[model samples]
Target: MGASHKKPSQDDSNLEIYSLICLDPSFHNNEETVKAQQQLRVSINYLKIFENCYQCEEYIRSVSSYNRFILIINDELARQIVPRIEQLRQVYSIYIHCLDKITNQQWAKQYLKIKCLSDQLDMLVTRIQSDHRINDLFPVVIYNTNELNFHFLYSHLLFDCLLRMNSNNKNKFISLCKNEYKNNENELNIIHEFEENYSANQSLSWYTRKSFIYRILNKALLTQNIDLLFTLRFFIQDIYQQIEQKKCLYPIRVYHSHLMTYEEIQLIENSLGQFISINSFLSACLDRGLALFHLYEPNDLQRVLFEIDADLQLNDMNHFGYIKLVNYCEETEQIFFMLGSIFRIENICLNDDEIWIIQMKLCTENDCQLKSIFNILRNEYHYGQDSNLLSFGEFLIKQGYLNEAEKYYLRLID
Candidate 1:
């Protein structure tokens, strides 16, 4: 105990290895393509800054007044610094330009070795920002690719990491999330790996990791984590059905996670501050909040209403306060609650009989409790421009409503 030694901060620590990335000379001429290259640089720089903090480097400047000159590598310098850039097999991405294929594999391997590390994706953005030579990070041409191979590699590595994390290290991983994920950044990373692992193990946990993953995936397939993306599709649906079957403690948790996706959320951010989810649309209508999209059946509507009510009464999510302010005690409550329960379904199960039966319940019934059933029925019936209208009408006839059922069939013929 002669001397107490303090560890270096994240900024001052030397990088053991640098994963150098460069653009193909053929892409240099195209302005948009060149822009994407520079953007990638900025994103990389951002990651370097992040590493400084996470690694606890000693050289990082004070927060109040700090120069952004740390690890500033220019693209022109990148060209001169790189010894070689090779075109590898197409399995990795659009083009592989680096010192060695092994380096690329090493970079790919790191994501799988840790949790939420992929979400530190600000590197691509930051690199683009710092590299004045390039203008765009994500170009329009790359958007058209049917399957993004790079994203697939990234996701596969992450899934491998999630699969590989030891049971004893669960607490360590959760602690990492609590430390790193302070903002909206890395939210998707938490969803992709942390949430999946936690849910599978029931030992690790985070507040909105499940919902965050669903929202991010609904956006563009940017994260490039293919294994996680495919796994989440089924994982989300399974959780939703679980809540329905078990009447879980957190139903909105399941429903929100089910409906929202990264692609959809990204679109909403670009177009408007609103997002579209099968569940959000149904939940909004059933709660009589804001109708974002169409509701397929009564059950869909009921699920949203139930979750909203439960979320409110439990004092968990009263952001909209649908339970407090809205007078669900009125006639609208019946319509909202009943229709919500009826419309819950996936695309495959949205059969003609189910639609017709639900619609008939809304149309023919002249209950004293409800006044404007016709408006709801007409609006919901016209929602799906499908060929199943006739079949649904036939279902109504079988249920003993001849006159009321004729309108749907006659409209189909017309």
Candidate 2:
């Protein structure tokens, strides 16, 4: 409410009114006041120009205090004035220090005005049947609120309507939005709208005409909808070929994630399973390394060890562990663990110095002579002979001889 008139002075009561503003809803917080002030401070100069013409300095001063305004004016002036104010407010902001007087009353007025305008705009276009009304207004309002230049608003609004409409009614809204695009220089918001609506129940095919499925695919993981992620993968299979040929990171992340589900894996794998390299598998293995512990038996562990060794010895043409672990004795640890697995030795012991020779010598397969040496190492007599007992203890653990490994590991400490 306007400050109640105390009638303290006749001169003060005679103040001129530039425009009368009324707020439909009031704000009740300080944060909204700060936001309104930030938005308005940038436009104060332009607003000052209007204020001067109407001699509304007192009203302007009040608005300037906390930077909120709900000035009412003739509807014709409003048609031009409201949009300019709204537009300027969208992009303009000043430092907080300049608007230190921000308060609840000012914010309440601004917030109510914004809600009123947004609601009015929403209601006005709900019934518009053609693209003509939206052609001049939409994109401006949708992406940039500057100057209320709603040149693109109609397209976005129509797209929203199209997405919500039944299959039969969808054509009408799409046609309206399309007509605006075709007649003007604007790209149909088809691509933009599809992205907006794709995550909804709306299908991915609806946006394919604009080639934005890649971006949609990129964001599909965020949807938490495995169904949608699968749908996106299926839709982009061909594009993924080109994307893979180019080695694009975005598509790769989407395609490689476990989030896609087994069904999704089959979809992608069926298309390019052979081309999905071991490097890619290993990359995923590195990420999914915990899968190693999930296996229920020795055979599963043996199978994994065999595959890892085969990959290292054959395809890798170099030791995998040498690169993976620093100061690693590739031949010794590698051969010993592999041999331990094969022989069921259940343990391999080595001191720090002996650990290196064991790792190196184990690299190449030698027969029962090395086997006898391994057996001697496993005997209880040599368990604490050197610091390498822990190394063998770890190998025992790796070989699934956990009890024996713990005995050795705890020996020096105990």
Candidate 3:
């Protein structure tokens, strides 16, 4: 399996533009406001004119890149529309033209005053033309009171930005975040510094801090930054506690899917020791059984199997984990271990055909007793006049067990 080494680019055809216009009805009589509104309408009309330029072009949609033109008539409308604009800023390079600033002035890289619509329109066109770099314009973060919980909104915005960045930039951003969080034991202090540094002087509420921490933790895991992940785990023990309490399997899934090195896996296991339940740990081990078997020594794999078996009692069977373990053992050619794992699974959990297939293999390889196989068929499986019984009889003949083959054929005939 080869990984694709794709680098991020700022292609103009891939970029999108969104223009948000919020007109304050309270300033209806003001000449400046009326002029601003008129200028905005004209600007939007000029931008729309490019839509037809791409009709005959192969990339028709790519030509204009203008996505949406939203108009807000009042403060209440602005309040409702600004948060949506903030959300859109993650993907589009939004040029907001409002009678008054709907959000922080520094939200976007460029803020054009709409005194003269013609002048503003020319500036917008010139700015976009000069700087065709998507990285320079994208992920515009805006602060709004619509979502009163600043921490939640900021965290999501930051995470979204981090995801969009290239690997090098993403690592740099994570490093910056880590530096800010250093020596800050207080959660509230960390939140304050994060908000102040990144979110334009906004502060996070106590209740929303946990959500922010969890978002960062998720990003760290996604990027496979074990160091950052461990650092975050130290600060947010409650987040891990919540995952353990809810028995959420997503973190384990993420670990298995992303973390490749044995050292990284060991770090996570040690950090989460005692916090992770035995069942959850066993399930994770089973999920990563093939990887573990390939990466670790035989002793380590045996130790993992022992731990799993110790957690599982004889009467406790029919679990999804057992099924996965048995499959892994079979694929690795550990026949006896596969048989032992199969024994832990309840008979009811398996179909008669499947049971017969496993028994036939065991009988041929280990010379398992005919009486034991018949007991399982008669008592456990209740195998009578079935197609599987006939198949098993033929299989026995192929294995040179003539006497056992004859017994099965006679039973089927009777």
Clashes of each: 53, 27, 0
Candidate maximizing lDDT? 3
Give all candidates' CA lDDT scores: 0.26, 0.25, 0.28
Can you rank all candidates by TM-score, best first?
1, 3, 2
Model 3 Cα lDDT, one tens digit per residue, 320-340? 221111121132211011101
* Stretches of candidate 1 exceeding 4 Å from the true structure: 1-207, 210-229, 242-414
lDDT of 1: 0.26
Off by over 4 Å in 2: 1-101, 104-188, 192-215, 247-414
TM-score versus the correct structure, for each prediction:
0.20, 0.17, 0.19
RMSD of each: 23.2, 30.0, 26.4
Total colliding residue pairs, candidate 3: 0
- Residue 291 in candidate 3, Cα distance off native in Å: 37
Question: Which scores higher on TM-score, 1 or 3?
Answer: 1
Q: After superposition, how far is residue 55 of candidate 3 from its true place, in Å?
A: 29
Consecutive 10-residue window with the lowest summed lDDT within model 2? 133-142
User: TM-score winner among the candidates?
Assistant: 1
Runs of candidate 3 with Cα error greater than 4 angstroms are: 1-93, 98-212, 235-238, 245-414
